[model samples]
Every structure is written in C-alpha cells, then in structure tokens.
Target chain A: MSELDIGILALQGDVAENFMSTMAAMNELGIDGSVSQVKTPDQISAVDGLIIPGGESTMIGQLSMVNGAMNALKEKIGSGMPVLGICAGMILLAKNSKDRVVGSTKQPLLDVLDVEIERNSFGRQKDSFEAEVSLDAMDIPSFQGVFIRAPAVLRTGSGVETLGKFNEKIIAVKQGNILATSFHPELTRDVSLHKQFVKMVADSKS
Target chain B: MIPLSGDLPKSKGIKSESVDSINVTKGTSTLKRGFAHMLKNGVVMDVTTVEQAQIAEEAGAVSVMVLDKLPSDVRKAGGVARTASIRIIQDIMDSVTIPVMAKCRIGHVYEAKVLAEANVDMVDESEVLTPADENHHIWKWDFTTPFVNGARSLAEALRRIEEGAAMIRTKGEPGTGNVAEAVLHIKKVNDELRTIKSIYDSGDKQGLVSIAREFKVSLDLVEETAKIGRMPVVNFAAGGIATPADAAYLMSLGCDGIFVGSGIFKAEDAMERARAVVLATTFWEDADAVKEAQKMINEKQSILGLDVNNLELRMQDRGGSA
Candidate 1:
C-alpha cells in the first residue's frame, strides 16, 4: 500500500495522544503512514484518514463549524475518506444526539454514521469506567475498553454494523468506511483498534 | 507475639499500607499519604492561559485545572464556553508533570477525548459547568484515559467509579463560590457509611438485607462506600473551594485532593494565594502553614463579581435532567 497520511483533528481534546497512538499503530502495522495534526479545513484534504480523538462533542462541533472545518469534514467523509471517531468524536459522527443534559447544542455533526447517540448515558464522571468488550466481528475475543464520560450508540441504522458491546449497550459501530467507538483506544497501550482502523484506511484506499 | 503497633486497629478490609496514616505532632504533623501519591492533598488552580499554569506550578500548586476562563467570566458572559486550547494544554503539560487536569461540559465525551489526546494527566466531567449533552452521562466504558467526575451523593460517586473513572470528586456547584453544599454532601456520605458498616458487622442475612434496602434509598452513600473500597482510585473535593483553609478542611474530611478554580486567581494576591493553597495541601494540619495561609487571604478581591462564570456552554439534554 502507498504511504497514507493520517491527521488528527486538533481543534480540541486528545489530539496529541491520538497522533502518537496512530503513528505507533501505523509503525507497528508496518504501514508507512505520516501522522500530523489537522487544525484547519484545508488540512483535511491532505490526509488519507482523520482520527477525531475523544473530546467534548459539542465544543468540537461548534468549533469545527465556527472554524469552517465541519463542512470540510462532511465533504471528506462524504468522499469516502476513512475516519475514526473515538468517544466524543463518535457523538459528532452520529446523525443525532439524545440525552444531551447540558442544553440544546446544535453544533455541526458529520452525520456519516446513521446512528443516534445518548450522550452521557453512563451517569456522571464518577460513573465512568473500563471493561473488556467483545467485538466478535473483528475476530477478537475481548479488548480493554476505557470509557471516560463516554456516549453510547443508542440506535444504529441499517448500514452500520455493531462492532462491540459492554453491559448490553452498543459501544462500537462501523458504517462503510467510517468507524466510531465510545471508548478511547488510544489512551491504552493497546494499538489493535488503531491498527484495525489503519487497515480499513488501507482497504479503502485500495 | 505480635507488637502492639502492628496490632493497632487498622481500617477494615483496607491493606495496612492502603489506610492513610495520620500522625499528630506538636509542631509538625505527619502529612497524609495515599496510593501512587495521587495528590490526595493537592491544590487546584483555575487557570486559563499557560502563563497562569506556570505561575500555579511555580507557586507550589500540586495540580492545575485548565479552563478557558475564570469562574467569574462564566457568571457575567453567558455563552458557550471553551476549555484551554491545545497550545496552552501542551504548554502546561510541558511546564509541569504534576498531573494537569481540564474540565469538559457534562457528557462531552469529545472534550474528554481531546484531553486524553492532549495527554492531560486527567479530565474532570464538570457539573459546575454546563454540559454538552443535556441528557446523557458520559459513558465511562469508552476511553482508556482516566477521568474524574463530580458527585453529589455516594451512589453517584460509586456509579462513576464503576464507570471506570479514575477518580471521584464532590460536586460543590461551581460559580456559587460557596463550599457549604460540598461539605454537606461529604458529611452525608460519611455518616451513611458508618450506619451501613454497623449493620454489616452484625453478620446476619437480615442485617445484610436491611443494609441493601437502605443502600437502595441512599444509593449515593452506598456508591461512595463502594468507591472507597476501591483503593488507589481518588475521591477529591471540587467546586467552590475558596481558600487554603477550605482545601485543608476538605483534606481533613478525607478527600484525596481539592479542585480550586476561581479561588486563587480571583484573589488579589494570585501568586501568594496559590502558594498558600499548595502549602495547605501538603501541610494541611500544620499550624505554621495555617497561620501563614491565613495571612495570605485577599479580602479586597472576590471571585463572585468577576465575569468568569459566563464563559461555558450550558447544553441541556432532552431526556435526562440532572
């Protein structure tokens, strides 16, 4: 596969860690991918894949809209660009969000994944936790999942395939070239999820 | 055969090493210690810019809570609030290794993700600030990064802990600048724990059932006790922490740390106040430090009048209400 350039959405939250983790995952997978930080709308065009790290979805969406990166993201994702949304990033990708306890947040959402998310269904920060999730489709037994104020995929559309679950709630889902997880895979030492996304990126490019 | 010191009453179930050792001395008191030096007695600085973070660090703060504005701003300027920028977060991370934390609106997993991506030592799901999603809680099973959450009750704290939050903090509603609510919540949790322990000690199934029944009614208390059982995980006090004494008082209540947002910067002597807060965290029981801290109080400047409170985005969920 040709060298793939990966960019982490750097507007807010977990950009650096995601960049480092993606790079590490690419290196581990023997994929020659250049990882960089993407802050502007134009930068989205330069990368083969985008990893929207975990962050406050509303802030990210609002900022991305104010900064004009939201449209760019939608356009890129529309063009079949492989993207991975972790935690808040997944909320941003969902078609709609439910249970947004703060207020009516009408930020730009990618709407790439035909799913509805219940933001903070896990109660409060004190209720945040970790567990082993079984993603049977990936042929993996279980993966260590880290959830910090995470969102759940309340309802997924027909195109989306459920990838993983914990406590009976869908935690990970993938639709075509888009992958979204309610947990932070990059936070852990585990790079398999990143590797899987990289593989998807590679497969899509091919 | 065993020495009296070895046989001295230790916290039930907690490993001898895990129980906090409190030693009282005439002039100096033995500083309380916890697992992994989790900053049990730490100072929280509400900082927006990297410069303030530096000042806080240099001033002896154990940790800093990076925000886009001081609490005063949120009260005056009503709008969507932003957290510290990536540049500032990186700058602060670069400046100090003493666990820098940032707040994300409630259920704003993306913010947590961003903080995690930034490699922030920890993130706080701040209830004092507005939430991104008004309805849902930030699901704890999502990210690998450790986070802290604010709780008003023991059940809330325990639920958060079960959700995989690395730490729990008492949610003393922010912007109020009053610590009364937090104090009450802490006391309630403690009092309920004692009651539950007594019932559990009776060693009867009926006693267990009664305790469980009580737990259902006071879910937060049960959760808090369960969280306490999970050693090494921190339960700090946050919101409305105003002075060195306040920080020290929280420590005295058995909080692992204190998250002070507007307390330091809002005061006239920002540096001096921050330094005093840091001192309080380490030497909370020391008379000299207390005396020194008392002198550092700034009566002229109050965080309430500042516009720090108006800066955050307060989105409410459609289904669930806090």
Candidate 2:
C-alpha cells in the first residue's frame, strides 16, 4: 500500500487550512498520506489528488493560469485525478459562471465541470453565515456549511449528482472524479466530506 | 476516471439556510472582532480603486483599506484627505470577496457612519486624513462597526482602546516610505508594556495606579493590558513600510500584522512588489525566502522615499492627548 499523495492548489485561497484539514482527516481515518502545497504544473502532475480551497475565483483562475497550473490541472483531471474544489474553487471548476449582481463577468474560469454557477448567489460578505446541511448520500448526517460569497449550481449535466442544496439550489455536486461544494467544509470541525474524498482517492488508486 | 456515486443525497428536510443579515446596531461587534482576529499574521494593503483592490486580493491581502488617494499622493497634494467616494467603495466591494476597509478623518463620527452605511467590513479612524476635530477622537464604542485607530505611544494606544478601538496601529509618518517612525512608535509602546508587566509581576498596586493615571486610562484596562503583556487588541505596524525586508523586519519586531500603503503601488513594479511583500510576510522567519523576495523587483524600481525629518506636517501628530 503506497502512501496517498495529496496536493493543494496554493496560488491563493484558504490553502493552509485545507492542507491542515486534509491531513487531519487522513489521520483520523488511520490512513498514511502526504499533503503539500502545489504551485506549479509539475507539482500538480505528481499529486494523487488535489483540493482547491475557497478563495476569490477570478484571482485564483488568473494566478493558476500565470503559473501554468490551469492547463496542467485540466489535463490531469481529464486523465482521472480526483479533486475537491470548495467555494471559489467550485466556481473555477464550473463550465460557466453568471454574476447575479452584474449580470455577467469576464473573470477567468476553468470550465471543466458541466455546471453553470451563479456567483454570489448566497449574498455579500456581511450576509455570509453558517448552517447545518444534509449530505446523507455520503453518510454525512449533518455537515456544517460555511458560506461566504458562495456560488450556486444553477444547472448541471445529466452525469452530475447533486449532493447538497441550500435554499432549494444545488450547492454541492460530483461528476466523475470531481467533487465540488459552494460552501467551505474546511472551515468546520467535521472532516466527513474530506474523509469521503480520501476514500474516493484510495478507491481510484485500486 | 472513476465513476462518482449515483445515489443523490436525500433532500428530505433540508431547508434553505436562513441568513442573518448584519445590522449596524445589533450583532456586528462580535463579527467585526472575529474578522480582525482572522487577519492575524496577515497583511492589509491600501488600495485606491477597484482594480487596485482586485490586485490586492490577488496578492493575498487579508483585507484592503480603500482611500481616495494613496497616503503619499495626499501628502504631495497637500490638501484635506477624506474618506473614499461611496461609488469607489461600492465598486471595490463588488470587485473582491475579501473584506474592504475605508478610512475616516480623525474624530469624524459622521464619516464613520457613512462608511458603515456603505457596508464596509471595517473603518479606520485614520490620522492620514486631516483631523476633523482637534480635541477628541471618535467615540467608537457607540458604533457596532469595529474601528482601527492609530497610536504613537502606549498612552495613545490605551486612550484609543479606552474609546473602543477594535484594533491599534502605530502612527508612523504616512507616505514617506520610511519605516523608522513606525519602528520607533512600536518600540515606545512595547517598552511601556514591559514596564507595566514588571510592575504587575512585582505586585506593585501603586505603580499600576500611577501608570494608569499617567496614561489617562482606567486602572482595570491598564492592569489587564499588562497581564496580557501587549495591546488588548490586534496591533499592526504601519507607515512607510516599502519593501519585503521592511515588512519582514516589522513582523520580527512582534507586531501582529502589517498595513502597507504607498510601499506597493507607488513602486515601479507594483505586481512583483505586491507578491514579494506577501511572500516575505508569510516567511519572515526564513532569511533565504526574504532574500528571494527582495530580488523579485529591482532596487531602482523602488519608490523614491521621502525622509520623515523634512516633512512640514507630521501625519502622526494629529488629534488626541500627547
């Protein structure tokens, strides 16, 4: 059994927290894995799995492109690398994004997932809040969801599964090896979502 | 690619998470306090426009302070510096997801109210702005929004805290790009803290009382400040910090975080300088990292800094007791 290698996109966002929580999840699961911040294309290619933490999606997308991580991430994910993108990270993973306040945005996006996301669907920064969300499909009885300028999944491809919804709008989705959520799970104490991602990574390896 | 689980999560009783809108007079203090706490070990840059705010967010600034002009520009223009335009503030708010802070003229309560109405994350009762009142500072405790006040000594810091400042920063000479004033201010406050700490350790009640009287603050706040051995709130180093080494040096000096104004955008290589500053701030302890950060931008590209000694008006000398 090889130690699972995890990489976090560190161009910007909650990189450190995600790295810490992923390690914590692995430790709690009695799993041996190494997690490190990945900033370049070569680093991203070496990881068994990747997690893009919540941050400004436009900034992250631009920075990732500048560092050549965008093309690398797209190629790797296309080849079967499991990934978990939170908040702005999820926005980057979407195929399209619409800004409700501005009507449209020209910000850079990855456009991988077959989902159309509405940016700032939750509300502004002051409107950010926390609440319990159900993810019973992953055996998560109730997961604490922290939403800060979070996006909403307006529509998804037939291949995608909606894992959680807030306000009757899809906030979490999975397609193939990709798992994305509009809310930040890393901000909470529960690592059940991360544990599920780790399990998905291990199963992919076998 | 491995196929994801097809089973959808049961949407049985999950209702839309109700959002509690933040109000000015209700539960904002805790929220603002926690927000300041979240900025620990981070950097906050002064940004003038939405594009600059976007750049600051990309450079990993914990938050941005929006102003009408950079401090250096205000100094050069030699005019009354006031809060940024509400339209600019709104554009900045929409540009980034991170917190946005706006400055108010010293002792201007109405300016603070205007900023709160604009929905800024924080208000800086800044001395960089020409003092609107010569005698007193804003009664910050009256507002639910947190305020960051500038101080040059232990007395100034205590006085501001007494008036309900959520955060304290050194009143270094703004716009000069000289780190000396900031250093001196931080040192003065820190030295006084050490004296009070010794007094507390020796169980000298009279000493504590005298110190409180001299600083013109409550004995309880003074004693608690000594017991904590630092400012009761987050203390950031500001004024004229212009380089990676300058930022790293202040972090080494024990400030909680940093506030950079003219240092970044004023530079010829703003983008590289911004990234270098963030890198140096995060890796201040590592000499090699700081060295690399310094090399990111050429020395000639650095701003031509003004000497603090020749300044006609000292921004730090505005408002409040000596």
lDDT of 1 by residue, A32-107 (tens): 8799888678898888999988755654665576557899999999999999998878988999886534433454
DockQ of each: 0.01, 0.16
Model 2 CAPRI rating: incorrect
If scored against the real structure, what TM-score would every candidate get?
Answer: 0.50, 0.72
DockQ of 2: 0.16
Judged by TM-score, which candidate is best?
2
lDDT of 2 by residue, A74-182 (tens): 9999999999999878998989988766656666777789999998786554455556688877888788677665789999998999998876889899999999998
How much native contact recovery, as a fraction, does model 2 achieve? 0.04
lDDT of 2: 0.80
Interface RMSD of the candidates, in order:
17.3, 8.2
Model 1 Cα lDDT, one tens digit per residue, B1-322:
0000111123121121211232111100000111112243455677988778868766656567888777656655677675668788777766553346787877787877788677665677776466677666676445534467777665565555545455677776565566775687677666755665565455444654555464343444343343334322456777677777887887788776677877777777788777767666555666676667767776566454322234243211111233
